[model samples]
Target: MSNTSNFRDAFRQAKTQALVGPNVIANALPYVGGGLVLTALGSYGGLGVLRTNPELFLPTFFGAIVLQLILFFVSQNVAEKGNNKVALPLLATYSLLTGYTLSGLIFVALKNQGVGIQGIGLAALGCGVTFIAARQIGSNLSEQDGMALTKTINLGVIALVAVLVVQLLFSAFGVYTPNWLEIAISGLGVFLFVGASVVDFYILPRTYKDDQYLPAALSMYLTYINLFVFILRLLIALNGRD
Candidate 1:
């Protein structure tokens, strides 16, 4: 009788220790929302500064990029090591820096092309649709499907890097890219980033422990920002010839 009781107690403990998907999602939402709010504020502030002092544009843009990259790697390291205290702040800082960099592009789009509102609206729409799709796709994932998705994500990253490298080469050589090529690249960016967002969302519940919510949220936040930026650029590029 005692042996049976012990076995039951051990099984109960193991069950209690298992990670709960809903609980992880619930814990992550607040951090993701907070990151978005910070990004919005940073973007607004950056736009104002750039508008007031156009001469500072290059410095501000490059500085934000550098800072964001640093914070991103550091945050990833901290998060992977399960240091929530350090990781959360680092992630927040990275988001704000990214917003600042994006604001420079936004300001130019608004002033030169007058497509700011359209870009914002489209970005919001893209985010909403991506979130819904991610949830639907993520919830239905089995272990086998998750493995396949992992491979897809890896391939997606490689493709994204190749695209970026080609764009940089064109820029470095001062080659005049055709309008159609620019539009195509922008469209590709939108698709790639949205796909990344979906993958992140789908894998979050499957991989992360409840205590690892900070990192999970950080991953989603990065995807959200990337998706918005890609959509914004696509919209602006499309409107340029109009």
Candidate 2:
């Protein structure tokens, strides 16, 4: 499970972590931006691999995914404990691996005449817009409303994840999602992550004290990344095959 999932589970309880981290969300923002920059670099590197060594891409991508899973737990634990020195590099590596994993989707987006570079830019811009709106709306959410939305989005995410696993399994057997189904799945994903982005603004501060900004950054990073992925997917789905 990811660090974000752990925090999600933790927040399911009635109690919350004490407000130890004053201005924790603010502290986490710079790292979030830095991590995104690293992710962009990593994606560029992965694109190089895809262009020059296509056969190796799948193996390396899977390897990156497994390593990212391991690193997620380790880095989140260390960061939450306020061990910045140890956690920083680990989290940075984790972010890079995430970007590597993302490259496959990006590759598809890039190759399609419909999606191209412009679609990628739109996907990124969509995430930025979601962050801006989420910050505005989520920061103002009342506790009751926030919790309600969290529970709703959590359930949706669980269902969506299950669906994606099934879809991936089918894909391995040479079955593919129909265009309409892809559109539906991608649309739902975009909605859920946008909602999740909003929830992050509400929950992160309550869950992590200002000292624990790294974990907070991790959670937010995951949110934006997923949002970007789905927005790109939705774009591809709507545009259809080239």
Candidate 3:
């Protein structure tokens, strides 16, 4: 399961195969839905902690990041080996940690003018729409088209990660992305992930067996999470910074 920058690593682990699991995507949908719910719960819990003991947020947030990364690699290995029993809880925890990490940006979204709950809802809606559209578009793609799009999007995503790393380092030194640059970055993020959402549909069946639904679900979950983040960032950028 992969939906973010981690996807590149996951893809590198195995070469793509012929379509093996027609029902795998369907089977994975429930877990994907469940993961999103858990993520929301985790986000809510994070928000509560932020409100009650703001001082604790930074350390715990960083701790969560480290823990999530560890759990992610471990779970992906276990799941790839078909050890769902161990992997399920690990992935559950990973989702929660991811939501926890998202709290800071979500908090910012909550406070930004013209981009409160409504904007959050719109971001979510945007993912839903993208999913619906991607399913149709990606499913119908010819091999030539699919491969081309996948290559293009993956390259774009790698480039975006590089730019983001640079931006993060700059921010750490008291420099920040300019408003125009912020908008560009965020907008590109949304575009790339929308393309990614489509790529998942095309790639999953080709890559995973029916029993490998856990990884498939993980792939979809991270896509939506990233999509939501970028959409929220785009809205904030467009609406003016807080």
lDDT to native, each model: 0.69, 0.85, 0.86
Per residue, candidate 2 scores C-alpha lDDT tens digits across 8-118 of: 753653266345555988999999999999899889989999999999999998899899999988997898789999999998998898888888888889989899999
Lowest-scoring 10 consecutive residues by lDDT in candidate 1?
A: 1-10
Cα distance off (Å), candidate 2, residue 209? 0.7
Task: Give the candidate order by descending TM-score.
Answer: 3, 2, 1
Off by over 4 Å in 2: 1-7, 17-22
The C-alpha TM-scores of every prediction are 0.84, 0.94, 0.95
lDDT of 1 by residue, 148-207 (tens): 665575566557667767877988899756778877877876776666665665556555
Clash count list over all predictions: 0, 2, 3
The regions of model 3 sitting more than 4 angstroms off are: 1-6, 9-17
Model 3 — TM-score against the truth? 0.95
Best by lDDT: 3
TM-score winner, 1 or 2: 2
Q: Against the correct fold, how does model 1 do in TM-score?
A: 0.84
Top model number, TM-score = 3
